[model samples]
Target: MKNKKFFSAEHKKYLRKTRLNRLLISLGRWSVLLFIIGLWELSAQLALIDPYITSSPSRVAKTIIAWAKDGSLWLHSWTTLYETLIAFAISIGLGSLLAILLYLFTPVRKIFEPYLVVLNSLPKIALGPLLIVWVGAGTKAIVLMGILICIIITTMSMLQSFVAIPQEKILLLKTLGANRFQVLFKLILPHAIPDFISVLKINVGMAWVGTIMGEYLVSQAGLGYLINYGGLVFNLDTVMSGIVVLCILASLMYFSVATLEHYIHKKRNL
Candidate 1:
């Protein structure tokens, strides 16, 4: 009975602490955001900063609402979202497959590893004109840009995870008469699940960056295009509104990956 009571108290304490931590995190996040918004509004109202140059939260909100009423907001947002999702899916599929191939074949890895590093290090912006010349200014160029940005990182990260797996396990599997395919499927892939999830989380942001950069170069529609147009017209509020929307969209995508990671962890634990 004493042990049962001790366990019960411990469980309650754990629950309380967890709740407190979550509350603190939420409060801190909102507090910082609110402080920044308040300061921006105050500065704008006082004319300490020109609202025309640096739009306030209110101006951004108004611009978003105006766009929404005109129906252009959804059109541009959907265009960007569609391009990003397509690129993201393709990058994950191609990257994972290529990483697996590289891991299984030493010669392939050796031949391409240096090239991957060089490509990754090269500034993507420099390739914009070439891409335009190759694919023309459209969705294809935008999607390809995002794929270029995300695929190398995914391959490098997953290849590292594959290489990091314990050699002893592979040797043991071989001793048990497990063939290469069996070892790869049952051991390497399972061990790399967490790494795959981490890559997804990171690629979400990289995909957005690439897509936005591409849109700036070639898109007739998209949040990035809106920002570019706004800048050309000196519409700071519209630019700020596009930036705000991009932030929210990126946050939502990140949280979706985090949720998937949580589900994966729960399944693995079970």
Candidate 2:
């Protein structure tokens, strides 16, 4: 009974220490954020910087609140999110299919590799005018931009990982009577899982970049449009609010991808 009580006490102490560490970490992160905002606000108030241009955190917060009350901001945010998700999904699906095709056919892979490298090298924003002419404005253009950004990156990343599988492993599989399909599924695909996760993580940010750039170039709606409108009208607060919202959204998407990466890593370890 005494030993049991001692073990219970030790477990409680460990839990307390873990809770304290978590609280400290959270506080440290928030403290740094608050310090930066406070410094910005102070600079603006002291006339050391142009508040009209730079804006302050409090002003941005108020602007967000006003937009939230009106419902326009949420609508724009949703439009951007929808376009990004659609493009990301299409890119990942098509890229995976294309990667498999490349793996299956040596001639096809050779023909496509140069094209992919050249396309990836080209400035994505430069295609804005052509895309607008081809696909028109609004969601379609944005979705196309996102797809263009992701497809090449995903294809290249996954293709490299697919081909990087050890030759000895492939030989072993073949000797064991595993055919092309079996080798692909059991060997190449499993080896490419981590790379696929990495591509997903990268595309989360790249997709957002493409979506916003498309919107900035030509869009009737979305956070990009809001920021452009704010800039035109000199509504610094509105611009700052849009900036904050974008940061939050991008961070959330990044965190989601990171969580997925962690899950895959853990699963693979097991």
Candidate 3:
């Protein structure tokens, strides 16, 4: 039989209201986007702004369609996406491992902590010249750039999460004769799941920034290359199209993280 006791009428009413609110909010967001696009297009048609410079939505769409027909759209997008994904994965894996090590060893943390801060503060763009010279103008340089941008932030954030775990819990585990590795894997890591997810979300944008910046410096392929080429050749429409595609890509990545978060929450609730 259904659990009638748990299904209160007020709870059902609240759920319906929440769903309706969410729908309205989503509609409002799209409405605002369409309104702005419409205004922009209308202004361009009326000669209120230079469409050549600003690149209206229609022009961007046309540019994208042309790229699609030429079959370069996916090629460029995939190139950037590949670099970003690889960098993202490496940064997460390496950063998390490093963070755990730092948390486990106070001396190591003390020695490297200041350097991490310095590296994070350093403008990654400034290292492009050095990276190019070191790694050459290749995908390796691009991936390295992305890793440099993301790794320190991931390490710091995750280390903080590890440090923030309840001291009492660790003490309890130790008192119960649980080893360091057991405590880390069974307790610390589990508790830090939300922090790890947050790091992934933050790293998504960082990875994109790193990839595009690297592309700007060295890439012959990718959306960043297209944007740079278009700007140099005075093709504002192509530049805007590249930017729109990047925004779409970033949004998709962010939503994927959000979906993972939702799944995790659902599992926890269950």
Candidate 4:
């Protein structure tokens, strides 16, 4: 009973320390962000920097407020969000499926391995004009661009995870008479969870980049469209506002993945 009590106290102390660390880390992040914003605002106010071109935080906030009041902010945000989510979903789903297929068929993997490498290395932006011409300058083209940017990466990441499974484990499963499908479901898929989470985190940024790039090339409405339009009109504040929103959205996505990772780790510990 005394030993158990001792361990219990130690565990509680460890948990408290962990929580405190996390709290301090979050505070530090916020402090840095606030410091930067405060400095930017001060610089602009002092005329040390040009607010018109550089765009102070206050001006950007006002621009966002105006957009919010006119409902254009929500409209553009939703358009970009919709495209990003679809692209994210497709990248994860189709990429994992392709990875699984490649793992299942060695000959196919060999045949497409070099091609995939080449595609992944190719600058996706170069294909923008062709995509617009082929997909006709619409949301489809935008979503496709996002998918094209991410799917290859997702496929490669997932396939690496699948292939990295220990040979001994596979042999053991086989020695126990486990077939290919059984080995995959019982061991491989489960093993890929952590890797998949990491890939999700990476794809979040890639998805946004692809979507925004598509919008820059051919978009009627989206944050990217707003930024492009604002630039054309010399509305620096509007451009900054769109960029701020994009950064916030991307940060949110990254944090969401981090939360999932934390939850999974906690649950595993439990």
Candidate 5:
């Protein structure tokens, strides 16, 4: 007890308030979710809408349970998850490398900047057919589609973050006789991290879009294919189940990134 430190009364009060605020925020989120779910189920029970077409929450859940029993859920889930993760990893790796290269070479950056801008603006969906012809109908095409959707944005976003570093900082480092590589490692890379995380959050959605689009075109497996197949047969339950599962998966990936951001923020504050 003697070795322990105690906060002032005001500090203790503030801490209590902070905890209460966090509790309230969590409660609010759950309450809203429950309210929506209750409303949906109630509507379905009353036949407010056609559950056959709209697919009620219970119907979706039942379908999901059915999939779980049959094992297709696991297979399809793994296929989509695997392709997405592969594309995500490659996009981040290749995009960051390209950004660094552009940052290090002014002439090359100047030459390619316009083309990159145009390509980034191009509708990537239009490239789906081209990708099919080039890579054949399969995971290669799907993963490439996913990569194409986000890689340019990643490169541009990261490059801007690096360039956004105040010129004064660069001059200071130069004044200290730091080389370009030293400045990059010590300053630019660290400063760009927050932006990199933001780009990651954005790319999560883009990756899903690309992968799903590819699956729509040629995939034999994955959530995207499941959804497409369901729609073709008017299997509302299956379609809704696939959609719900996709949402859950995407939410998981997004929250994972958010968790990383939170951890980084906490470490920085510490």
Candidate 6:
């Protein structure tokens, strides 16, 4: 009974520590958010900048809430999120496959490496007009644009991770009678998981960028469409609201990737 009581006390202490830590982290994050919004509100009130162009935090918040009540904001957010998720899935699936192929085949890598580099460096906005022309105006074109923006980066990052596995490890696997296919699947892909997560984090932003750019040129829905419409009509509050929503969505995606990265690293270390 004494030992049981001691164990219970220890568990309670651990729970308390975890709660405290979570609270501290939340406070830090919220403090930064509040500080930025406070500064923006103060600046606008002081007339330090034109509120018409720059907009205040309060105005942006009101605009978002207003759009939300009208269903426009939620609908647009859903459309963009759907397109982004679909593109992200395609990018990760195809990019990782291509990376593995290139990693395994010297001839394939030699032929495609330069083109991959060029494609990665190319401005995705340049493809906007062409994508709309080919895929038509709407979610499909936006998803395609996002996929193109992300695939090259994911390929390059995952390929680098695959090659980064130590040669000694490969040698050891070969001595164990593992064939090329077995070695790649059993060794390289597992080793590349952390890098792949990192690549996904990057692809999230690229996907957003591509989707937004595509919307600017095409599409009748999305936060990007809202921003374009806002600018055309000089509705600064609407534009600022769209920008805020984009920031929040991107940050959330990045945070999710970071959590996955942490989990992968912890498992690896253990």
Model 2 scores worst on lDDT over the 10 consecutive residues at 1-10
The per-model lDDT (C-alpha) reads 0.94, 0.89, 0.95, 0.94, 0.93, 0.88
Candidate 4: give the clashing pairs: none
The C-alpha stretches of model 1 lying farther than 4 A from their native spots are: 1-18
Query: What lDDT score is found at residue 69 in candidate 1?
Result: 100
Candidate 6 lDDT: 0.88
Q: Which whole-number lDDT from 0 to 100 does residue 223 have in model 5?
A: 100
Candidate structures ordered by TM-score, highest first: 3, 1, 5, 4, 2, 6
Error of 4 at 213 (Å): 0.2
Least accurate 10 contiguous residues by lDDT in model 3? 1-10
lDDT assessment of candidate 2: 0.89
lDDT of 4 by residue, 104-200 (tens): 9989999999999999999998999999899899999999999999999999999999999999999999999999999999899988999999999
Candidate order by decreasing lDDT: 3, 4, 1, 5, 2, 6
List runs of model 3 lying over 4 Å from the truth. 1-16
**Where does the lowest 10-residue lDDT sum fall in candidate 4?**
1-10
Give the winner by TM-score: 3 or 6.
3
Each prediction's Cα RMSD?
Answer: 2.4, 3.0, 2.0, 2.8, 2.0, 3.6
Best by lDDT: 3
**What's the CA error at residue 133 for candidate 1, in Å?**
0.6
lDDT for each residue of candidate 6 in 1-270, tens digit (9 for 90 to 100): 556566777798997899999999999999998999899899999999889999999899899899889999889888788788888889999999898889889899999999999998998778888887887877888888889988988999998898889999999999999999999889988877777777888888888887888788888898889999999999999899999998899899889888888887898893
Query: What lDDT score goes with residue 80 in model 2?
Result: 87
Give the Å shift of residue 238 in candidate 1: 0.9
In TM-score terms, candidate 5 sits at 0.93
Tens-place lDDT per residue, model 3, 183-233, is: 999899999999999999999999999999999999899999999999999
Question: Candidate 2 clashing pairs?
Answer: none
For model 1, the run of ten residues with the poorest summed lDDT: 1-10
The superposed Cα distance between candidate 3 and the true structure at residue 63, in angstroms, equals 0.9
Q: RMSD in Å for candidate 5, one decimal? A: 2.0
